[model samples]
Target: MDPLYTTTDDPNDSMENISSNFTDSYNNQFVQPVWQVVVWAIAYCSIVIVSVVGNIVVIWIILAHKRMRTVTNYFLVNLAFAEASMAAFNTVINFVYSVHNEWYFGLGYCRFHNFFPIAAVFASIYSMTAIALDRYMAIIHPLQQRLSSAETKLVIGVIWVLALLLAFPQYFYSTTAELPGRIVCYIDWPEYKIWDFKLTYQICVTVLIYILPLVIMGVAYLVVGLSLWASEIPGDCTDRYREQLTAKRKVVKMMIVVVCTFALCWLPYHVYFLLHMFHPDLLEERFIQQVYLAIMWLAMSSTMYNPMIYCLLNDRFRAGFKQAFYWCPFVPEGSYKSLELKTTRYLQTQISMYRVSRMDTTVSTVLPFGTPDDTTEPAREEEPGCLRHTAVDLSPNGSTRDTHSKTTPPPSPTTTWTSED
Candidate 1:
């Protein structure tokens, strides 16, 4: 069989002729038009800048403020880490490979180039899954045990471990192979079972990375939405209780948008990958190349939007982000005051409810301090943020008290701080 891309015809050709021909071929294959290179450079740089900066800000905000360290935020932190790592390591490499069609980074990095992104992607998707589950448990079974910090750590550890295991195939099969005159970094399967191996791996990744998480997130959120929209508040429910519920629901809504966005961004990329796998001829078409680039861009851009979603939808995260960007004149100290007041009111209301029910010795008959229909004093504008709740204990004397409660702490020093898992 003729060599796929070789330029030489005779073994008797001089070494100088072979070298010259190879250089010409390599340049022809690898060099992009100047205009195309500029366009791709801009696109890749923008994505890398947004993803790395946005996710780093998220991670920093979460770390700086203890108030931001909720179970859900922890997962977000994990996601930010994955996104930042992926953007840092893969963005330029992908751009060069797509534009140049050569592997300049050599064999060692070839394995890592493929493996790290896969691992990071797996970690990111599963982190989102973990958040969905946490939210489901919080909303669907509020009274049941919440995941403690230690348990959350365990789950995160498991996610990374699984991601590493799943990405081992890239490490095993990715290498730099000479094609014609250029070295290309690609996954090469054994000849005997190449198609079978590829098909199995592709199916597994599609199912595990995209399909499974999306399905579980959809189901979990569906249940959570039903429970929130359909369930009735207690007869004596206070504004604080309603506010807390509203806050929780806002979180659910934000997460729903996040999951939807993730699915939309990744769908085309996965489709393209599967198509290329099944129809290798399509890879040679310029239109298909453009489509693939667009899809990959969308997928890469997914990492840039979560922090924005959190900032726009969740008051607490918004506040955290504001704090993170405090140098900007837009985020003032007063922005957080309203959220603090609301949080303080919530804590006080829970305590008041416990005390009033205790005095009356009747949990069912106790009336709320204020009418639910009546609005209290006007306060700063607010939306769904964060909350802290203590367990309630009922005594034999027909009194209710908090199992482990204390005076509400002072407000955080600033607002608009956000964090990640």
Candidate 2:
């Protein structure tokens, strides 16, 4: 959410005396030097550029490729869309308003400026929360049914609906006021004789958007981490099992880093606002403008880091990024194409073959002699009615030699694959 500034409703308050009451100030008295303004402009502009471009690429990577359209990636696409929309629509406007201490745009944008960031932030954090829950279900309870594609879309829609509901108050109360010398946009919260509504709303927003979701994700990841990392693998575990475990661990680790980055970036912003709510005198300080700008820049910078996290920590996302940027002179077209084209098929075939070989070994090991008993148990534990046999050419000459082999179904019914795999 954008930082809230104190504004007054009085038309008689002159520009010079505006800073008398920090809660009733319209025209800002503190002004930075030319060089400082230039530096800040560059800093803020960099965020907008990197955030918009990076998140759009992430969205495209997930949406354009059929192979990348998994449940996790769907939530990621929602996350990327929220970040990109916030960066494109709010980042520059936020910078300009905070730096200039005036509203150049009229009333409609003022409402949007105040409204959209809250919804976007709500969407961003909830999307991450959805991912945490999804991962927990996938890793901690492997045999459970996962969300289908349609259900995933429904969840995303529900997230946005809640986001809009949470942010509607900001949109409703936002208005532009003509001060002594300039115009300023701020929320004209209605007064209540019983309680301070603005402060109450601020506290609620911080709890809902920042504290609560982080706590839930923190606990979910904690259990998932223990399940994934603290367990001892069996001595007879196959390489296939090890690969799946490692893939799950990598995904959990990547998400942990993303969550940590977000928490750190917004921690200062939240603290600053809380302090201001309790003590309005802080806004009257001469250096408060610079402090606000710095804190806000850090908070807004969170929108740009997720794409980099995905590219660095996940192999499939890395390959998707390579394919997206294959036109660059430094990126080799051949290798990029191979990474995109061959990796999926190669992994699938290797897994299939390994499953077949493992089943063959199990059957041979269980029944050495040609005698079959009804009491004899299967070598491995599998879901009921899940085993299926098919004919494969196991001959070295690639001739039509009928060798029966067992293969699991497509997309793996038990475990969900992350974008990394």
Candidate 3:
């Protein structure tokens, strides 16, 4: 197969050839217009500010609210944490590089600059995928437990491991290259910095991060979305099952929005590198090269986006964020952890009550009453639930039957209620 890109193939030679071949001059646009700088600066600031405040609040919310801890929300928490790390450590350095045209940090940080972004992207993509699958399972099989707290821990551990493993190239294969009086970070590859192994790895990252996972994400969202809309569970609106389905639909829709944004943002950078697979000639154009850089930055910027998605779109998360941001009354000072504990207690109490009620109606009612001698009636009354009773009789065959005839009454008002087996 032909090589994707060969650095030694003569970039200057192609430029000279193109210059001589064309009537109009090759107009390599220097840095984008000034307004673009203003716009990007504003974006960068928003990203950085939101990245910090947003993620801290995200972390605070998850840690501060028992209600926020779920299979899918946990993945979002991981994603937000990773993005916060990037915004704090990486984003500014990128700005410095763009403006000063040099890497102010040493070789170590240059490695980190590449390494962190790759890791962050990996974390974000997989986290979103994890959430997607979790939602799918929850919607499709609510009766069956999908992931437990321990299982969620295992999944998270695997995510970090995979993220580091995928980011392997950036740590070792990367090096600082001297480009036009500025030291910039690029991969030191098999043949050279910009060719061969570097190109190969770029393609690999794109496939792993964007293409394959994107395909999986699409299928996951499709299954989840369809299930929500087309559930066999009936109710116009107030039905219990339908209400649950409605909630599931809202969650899947938000997930779709986040995932689609991710795919669109990263597609360009992937295509820019993959283009080399067919024609290395395409990359020779300086304009094309700048566009490539822009695409990559935009993709990197997406790391800071999901936390925004969570904070703005999710009501629970929005409340938590407000508390963290404005010291809203919901989150008390120095007692957020206590608040979470209270929330846990509250949910547990609710669950316990429901269990007791169900057991009282099912098993507790079927058992004989405490007064064994009280067999005045032919048989005990059948209770659907609660104190509600129906007189059921035991036929000569000794099989219990539902007899709704009002003539029979419970031996005692406090007797156990019986329901269908």
Candidate 4:
């Protein structure tokens, strides 16, 4: 058989095999040419619709809401922006490549294709870590100055820097490799280097981005949940029930919605990479590869989910969306409370206010309240006092671990909880 005609699955095939057999194998792998094209096209279009629309709304919600303009939300907005970019720049082009099995965008973009996802995903994962830390601070130490707007901005800045740092290797090593009938892009790592670099990179990044952050977030949320649970009110009067219901249910539910979704979406992608590392034969299996790709895509889809979780799980986000999108009896003269979230009575001294967001600073009127119902399934409220806070605690003086006080009660319910679904 000619070298160019060999199957990728055929161990004996050479890169020189650029003949009819290669075409046959490639076509057979897809099974039906038209169906493969159709499926890819449909998948691409769906991803585009979801990533663009969902992330745009997420950005808008964070941008438009004053309360959401905080440090944590700022990182979230950055994440939303990153995912939107990946969708616009990466997903559509990847679809084209899948359909044609060719790289026409030239060497530069081939490098871009090879490198950008690494950067974007890195930024994305790092942003989540930042958010996780932020929540950890707020939940563990309620009295301390939680993340300031300035600090959040700095953290976001650092995340991008780290992402680029990790991604910089791409600029040095990626290029298109030509074959008789095909061209492919890859990093310059040889077998040993590739395995070493990829393994180290994957392990470290996973620990920082997924494992450690998750472990910390888990603990913080647990403490927060426990705090809220301790504050839950017993049945009897309506007003006390309502007060406790509002405070606890809204906070706890929103936290669960955010953290749980993050965990679930990211798991598949992480596992796929792990499996790929140990099983070269598994990679050769077309169906398995497809499954791996699907999971990676699913994890990428989380960028669009924050808005949904925020709106559906929290009455406050829901009200904010309503205010953002529809009519107001008043000329947008609404309090955050009117949007359903009560502002903290105390300013809660922050350690380093990080010179950002002056009181006079105005936000662009772009966010819709709650989440849009059309994009995903409508969510029902769960048990009362269930809304948990998403924040990380800090030492009162901003010391790494000391000087923090524990005073504010998780604030017990003065009202009854209806456990609305």
Best by TM-score: 2
lDDT of each: 0.65, 0.71, 0.57, 0.54
Better of 1 and 4 by TM-score: 1
Candidate 2 clashes: the total is 0
Higher lDDT: candidate 1 or 2? Answer: 2
**Candidate 3, lDDT over the whole model:** 0.57
For model 1, give the 10-residue run with minimal summed lDDT. Answer: 370-379
Candidate 4 per-residue lDDT, tens place, 227-277, comes to 556654544324433554444435545655776787898888777666655
- Which model scores highest in lDDT? 2
Per-candidate TM-score against the hidden true structure: 0.75, 0.79, 0.68, 0.67
Q: Write the per-residue lDDT of candidate 2 for residues 1-421, one digit (tens) a residue.
A: 4444554322223434444554354334666788998999999889999999899989887777765666777888999999989988998888788877778999999989889988999999999999899888766664566677799899999999999998998899887766556777777677778998888888999999999999999999999898878878655544444555666678789889999999999999999988987787687677888898899899999999999998888776777778888779996553444224221211211122223453233111110110011111112212212233344444444445544535333433443332213
TM-score of 3: 0.68
Which regions of candidate 1 deviate over 4 angstroms? 1-31, 193-195, 231-236, 329-421
- What lDDT would candidate 4 get against the real structure? 0.54
Question: On a 0 to 100 scale, what is the lDDT of residue 99 in model 2?
Answer: 74
lDDT of 1 by residue, 1-421 (tens): 0011222211222445445656664356535579978987888888889889889988876666654555677788999999888888887687777666667898898889878887898999999899888777655665456676678889999999999999998688765556565676666644443357666787898899999999999999999898877777654444555765666667778888988998998898888777756665564444544565567778888888888887788666676677667788867763653223222111112222223454344221121121111111111112222233345555677667754322222223432212122
| TM-score for candidate 2, residues paired by index | 0.79
**Where does candidate 2 stray beyond 4 Å?**
1-5, 8-28, 332-334, 337-421
